[model samples]
Target: MPSVLEIRWIMRPASLLVVVAAACVGEPDSSPWSVADSAGVRVVEIAVEPVALPVYASVGELEFTVGSIDGTDGPAFGDVGEVRSLPGGDVLVTESRSQTVGVYDRSGRTLARMGGRGDGPGEFRFLHVAGVAGDTLWIWDPIPQRLTPLSRSGRVWPVVTFEHELADRPGDLRRLADGGFVARTRFQPLDPLDPKYAESKVWTDSLVLRRLDAEGLEIDTIAIAAAEQLLREIWPSPTGEGDGRPVGAMLPFGTQAHWAIDSIGNSVVVDGTSGQMVLRDVRGSIRTVVRFASPPRPLPEAEVERLRRSRLDDVESSPFRPMVERVFSKELLPTAFPRVGGLLVGESGTIWVAQYATFPEEVTEWTAFAPDGEPLGRLSLPARFQAREFGEAYVLGAHTDEFGVQRVQRYRLERP
Candidate 1:
């Protein structure tokens, strides 16, 4: 197996991998990883370094060419759930509240709109933007269990309905360049000890992503990752020495493995347990493993208390006030920050790994990695936006405005 150190040239030009600091020349203070090779499968132990945090002030000033879509003239998005960039500087957005799809140009002007709340053809009850391939865009709704495609003009697609009787809940789904798709699914491992099925083992959850043909047939399962336990049931203790029942309380950030399929159908799987990811081919062979310099930070109990108290008004107003009271007690936080926050495979084959700062910051940071797993420094966005797709020279994502309206925006990413 070729080590990531040896695979750097295949994924990035030599200039991006040039050393800039002493930290990049030799092992920093200590070895950050432990490498082992067995049966040609290399497993490297990942430990985030304890170093000075990367500050936005050090990232220099940012310049953005902004484009936004809000409810002004044509179609104003009610709940902008997802956004994707198309080929011609165009964007597709899904409005969950309005249950509509809108197409916007680079200027963020709503050019075309389609679909509304209905059970009829080309309609959806609850919908989300899936992905765009060529001039066709796919929309998925779990309620209707349909994957419908639409033309660039927002017209109903001329092809057959995509089969979505999923064997697993979709973690992420994106259309592949070959009319196929790449998706990650969540699966629960059967616990032999728990026949009643009241309790769940955290390590039993797994994520599997597969490559599928355009006709909805599975081509290959490319990646499999172990998922962490979250939202476990806490029955009352017989000895009265435990917290109350936590009816599926969600974590602030997920520890489940996240992934993105590159333009050529390659899968980039980020491990939720470590600051690393394995880039693999469609055939499921490991091509390279990427790691970055990051340190793990424990969750601040004070912050947890603050957030819990901040929701007092909302909880008191909910109809299920009694249930809400038991959900987020003072003891509901994990010991450490989530291993990884988000992952994106850029159009240029640069992998973007989100920096999970415990507090709010000015610019969101992504530690970009070459496809061969070489660290290529960080890419900082001007705003705190959750980027969902990357175009040739832009980032497409949803950002909320001051009034709490989720709007889709695109910003140009000037890279070296």
Candidate 2:
């Protein structure tokens, strides 16, 4: 395991002014309406209108399959991070653990595996995600705080390093038209003793989103709370405690910021725990868009009673016990936030979002929207392929683990 100390030492400093500038340009607004269940979890319903058309099956919808490639002769991939569609139907996949890059064809064949684990010009120790801008592949290594450009042929370009303090883990990277990029940084409260330790923080706080430049410079930083209020109309309390606590007192615990950036550098930061999505434009106008109704499940009252009697000694045995206790002990239940599985912005300003019926499931349903964020239609993906984007076609990726063996597969989106 990589130590937190090492991660901090490798941190790079980037321009924070860019992020501030970006956040300043957006119009701050709240969601139009909100609804809540008996459990006190707010739910917002987005009015979706479906498009009428004879849906045709996309190319290679079921035409592709997963295959194994030898990593000994090429770059090895440990844990796959983000995968993106290249211009010529190719794909770029990030391997975090191994600190390498995997290039595959549309058919899932490994064309070339490049990049290595090092701090040198063409090397990387950890990378979060990558995006393609024109002919260059931009890889974002959050730990090192740098964005290194690579050629399609697996050659590394000059390194662009930035000086900035990024939270422990960084989010996805999106390519912009002006030859720059925007990425999100997630912040967690550092444990006084162990600064990087993360425990039961998910239920009570919101995360911060910092926009970075192409060189890993900080361009702007936006509180998830402000974004949530403007886009989802849901204002999350910063204090983990609900009543009497000042607003924006405590940051989001566990995982709070979930977002994706489009080709235009616009970002959609979704707070699944809060049922809000912060839509940020290039000019820094922020809109809180809320859609998705909380599920009908009531608070697990019986579980609450059981927890009260459970011994503190028993709780120490399981780390999850405290989280469960916190929720039930406080008369809270598991809330449902609309899962934005994948986001894609087309060349024509069309936005496609893959929605999950449940959390962490491979099967996905997709919705299309115009540039103005109007809903267009919905489509379901095939069982095996995990849907990412839906537009003139669909893009899907899948990871399988059977009998301890792991493999990844990609397929074209098809509509029927």
Candidate 3:
């Protein structure tokens, strides 16, 4: 077994910025852990076990401020997409609205502003914050299909073109351990009944994850997509339509996608969106699979309605409210709750799988798993905060105020 020192540097310079974590001391347990409740799924035995309670209150409260909002020369996020912890207790955030990336310290002071929106060298036409590779920050702009490296000192490295010859559009782009990249492609939806969808260019789909080398060439297949078919519109509508839906009504809901890459670039993918969590290593092979012992039952009709109503209450005002009502129709909610709503890979190789809340106002539950595929404990987050990145003790996520102002917040978790 590799020593903790080796595992700590699995991704090396690329991962050094994510977190300068303490090495996990000890060898991995090779014995398989089985569960009758998991439909006979195979597991692995690890020395670690659950040491905490079932719920972690105040975690979602966003009261513990490890990082704050900066509006000066730093970052005032109009639309926050991703947040990541840096080496020196700093954090990196991607603001999609303004097409910029900023680095902030624990006190919320701006360490550096990487780049702004533009078509020039440092200017980003399609801003995509990939990951930290030592002093180089990898950003991919899929529109121009280029991977541009931003130096730690704010210089633009030579652009690496992504000659994406795939049949599907790519979604999640994770820079891998060997300087390669792993991407999620969109799956093509079936024939569209609406004329507007006849040529939907930006709808999201992917039944499999693809890996590319450092040069942006296809290397291997990470994991196969779920068997389930879900059509999610990607592009936003002009005015009346929300999320590419028609002005008055919406199309069928798509499957919620949740996956996380560990410090080494190995991914934890939620299979079937419910039954299984597949752990694929850097070699594009399934190292061990993690299954939930007692999975929650699908949401019942009443619960589904309650969820829908909860959303309706959130709309402060809508000029298209009347139009939305006239044609507003929806397919039945998925029988089960979202298989997996969110995923976070801890710096220590632990996994946090977040389940969807019936409503945004309710608490969110997360199943924790050890590095060796052992199901640790579960925690219930007190409220809604869309977590973008996490560390040993804090969750840095995007939170919208009651007034609809977006802010990047850091919520510290107290196990007690």
Q: Which candidate is the best by lDDT?
A: 1
Off by over 4 Å in 3: 1-41, 44-75, 187-204, 227-254, 293-331, 358-363, 411-416
* lDDT-based ranking: 1, 3, 2
Q: What is the C-alpha lDDT of each candidate?
A: 0.61, 0.50, 0.59
Candidates in order, TM-scores: namely: 0.76, 0.61, 0.70
lDDT (Cα, tens digit) per residue for candidate 2, span 1-416:
32221232233123322332343355222322223342333233452212231122444545444344444433334555666667887777776677787777755667767788888777787775566776688777666667788887888888775565555445445556566656554456433233222233223333565666655567776435522211111122357554221111211111234565555556666654443455566655654354644442232445435434553445677644444345443423343323454556544445566553333445455565444443444655555444443335545455544432334555555544
Per-residue lDDT of 274 in model 3: 54
Better of 2 and 3 by lDDT: 3
Which lDDT tens digits does candidate 1 get at residues 114-210? 9899987788887766677778778876665577888888789743455655566564567766678776676554433353435632333677887
The per-prediction CA RMSD against the true structure, in angstroms, equals 6.2, 13.9, 8.3
Q: Candidate 1 — which residues are off by over 4 angstroms?
A: 1-11, 20-70, 73-75, 158-166, 169-172, 189-195, 198-204, 232-247, 252-254, 291-295, 310-314, 319-332, 357-363
Question: Whose lDDT is higher: candidate 1's or candidate 2's?
Answer: 1
RMSD of 3: 8.3
Please provide, for model 3 over 216-238, each residue's C-alpha lDDT reduced to its tens digit, 9 standing for 90 to 100.
67767777764433332223556
> Candidate 3: TM-score?
0.70
Cα lDDT over the full model 2:
0.50
